[model samples]
Target: MTGGGWRRTLPLMPASIPSASRENKKKIPYAWELVGWLWLAYFMNQADRQLYSVVQKQVQEALGLTDIQTGLVNTVLIAAMAVMMPIAGFLGDRLSRRRIILWSLLAWSVATMLTGFTGGLVSLIVIRSLATAVGEAFFVPAATALIGQYHVKTRGQALAFYQTAQYFGAVSCGAAGGWIAGQYGWKHSFWLFGGVGVVLVALMWRRLKDAPKTAAAIACSEPIGDVLRALFRTPTALVLTLALGCSTFVNMGCLAWAPTYLQLEPFNLTPARAGFFSMFYYQLFSFAGVLLGGRVSDKIVGRRPAFRVELSGVSLLLCVPTLYLMGATSTLWVVYAMLGAFGFFRGLYDSNIYASLFDVTAPRYHSSATGLMVGFSFAVGSLAPLALGAIKQSYALHTGISLLGVVYIIGSLALFIAARGFFPSDFLRNQQTVPTSPKL
Candidate 1:
């Protein structure tokens, strides 16, 4: 694809790729604009997910649901998202991503709005778990692949900035959703956030433009089996996927339970205050970590392709102690400090998840590859809520949460091994297999 129109210029290509790429210097600004749009989209995506947890307590009491039932609901939603990832990823590769993203936003937003109207657990499962999951599942693969396609030169930083939306959405919505639930009702909170998502959809429809379909992209678009085989054959990809699974397990459990944990026992904060404290300090420092990690990775990856993996390893290791401390400490200030440190390192690890995946996988398989990675991670993570809920019945929340440190330690080791052994070969292999030109 030419570097004109909505398509941005390709950066350094593999030595084996053809050198006849079209040179257009124009679309650079548009790339950043695309990032901006994605930032909003991702914000909505995360905020919508957090809505359930933010008001889960109220919903549980209103519906006379058990903790296990609440966990089941979270599991169903995450499982549905996992199940849809491959299909969504496949479509993202062949279809218009812009259109896919637009429709996804519309579908999930509508579901979120409709969630307010639910009268029972069955309806909540139908709307929030099944429908919402199906809609939201289509977003990440297409959106992240689009960013990877355009912002190749500034990919790390761009993606990092895009990820900050997660922190923003989670932290802000955690507080806002709790306040809304308390002031109005949990139902109105859903309505408010869902309405905001719908507005963003209109904005995206007007501003977001698709890149021109190019011959190289068409030629490179391989069958689903081929894409899967190519990605899975690489040891680095396998290791990375497993590591992500471990990370997701910790993340999903912590995010789903943190506020609830804070509301109980030693820190008995109210819903709004609990939500605020749960996400505020942790995500606040995390935002800085992501930006810093991205900038550092981009600047250093040339000389050290293993930089991303190493960073992830170190971050995960750091997170292990912080996570454990957050649970073990009875002192609220100590818990807060540990959580802040945990968030910072977690962000550092998260900033390169997709970037590291792209480093090994071919450009042609970006969407599908992302789908598989995300699908696997979420599928494993889906079990966390249920497991944690069950554990909470028999043990303290702190005990269950501290177990997450083990998962982080395992993931850290796996990544360290990948960096030392598999990364260089996988990185080289992907570069050689794909076209040099950036496809719009």
Candidate 2:
């Protein structure tokens, strides 16, 4: 494979399988099947994360926890994920990605189930923050890299399809958790989601198989320092990392507070209504944006490789006004409109993020690159919930939320810089590194 054309054959094969069987397997559309299974895992991953935010009020009242303490729960979880991401990325390159993903699903599900048993902040931090974070940190980089191996020509569309699970999970869990809390208790929501995750893990264990490693894959397993150096040397990757951090700051803050915000002010919604409204419009439009963005980018990217990055930059820039308006406005209808617009643009950016990064980095470095980008972004984002919590103490929550538009401005600018000045050279360098042997 090179810059001029896509590969006609699979890039990697299972070592244990014979050449005949490998070719037979390639004829089947198992890539989509992989996407299906991982979609379920990713759905559970997101739904579990959003449950705390959806039921924040109930949890806070039940445990006598203050705003800062509740904010600390999300902050610590992101922090732990950030700390573990690089190690997980390293392992993804060397070990069985299938095993890593399966184990991660099991570990996090168990921790989420145990969360129903927590009595106070300490146990919450231990189960929800540390244990769950450790589990989830292993899933994304490995899963994404695995997908990249399977679908080179349709990478953007496949990832975009996979990405929709995030919006669905957040929206569904937010609404369901709120209703469950109202009907029964916050604890049942946890147990229900966790049990579902465990079932998915068992199914995946039975069905998921690792891609056979190619000689190139085995040969390119560099030391951790080398992997880090390879990624940092690419200017576009660095800018993308910073861009991710900025966007994450806004996203994490909104996810943590938006439901509670709706429940309190001019909106004056019930808990279930607040949770549904907070997620429904934003994610629904976001779902549309990702699919459209993916199909457009895939159609044009062969001729305009940097189009993915450019699309991300443009989408982030477009989202700025809507994000600001969503927070500044008090009218419920206006807020919903802004949320939909903001989410659509966010989906456009999210659709191409990993695809854009993969375009600039060697295939061997995909997991490590994803890990570095995600870890740095999460570290930066971990401050958002805590910062918003502190800001709520001094001013209206909307004020803090409105100010997040500034971070988007900075991120969009960085992405524009990356697209224009650095992407061409970095992309060419990556294309040169990809092994062209037919056996691969």
Candidate that scores best on lDDT: 2
Any residue pairs clashing in model 2, and if so which? 13-212, 14-212
Model 1 misplacement above 4 A = 1-28, 219-221, 438-440
Global lDDT of model 1: 0.86
How well is each residue in 220-252 modelled by candidate 2, as lDDT tens digits?
Answer: 567788888889899999999999999988999
TM-score against truth, every candidate = 0.93, 0.94
Instruction: For each of the candidates, give the backbone clash count.
Output: 0, 2
Writing each residue's lDDT as its tens digit, candidate 1 over 288-328 gives 99999999998888667778888999999999999888889
Which residue runs does candidate 2 get wrong by more than 4 Å? 1-28
Error of 2 at 250 (Å): 0.8
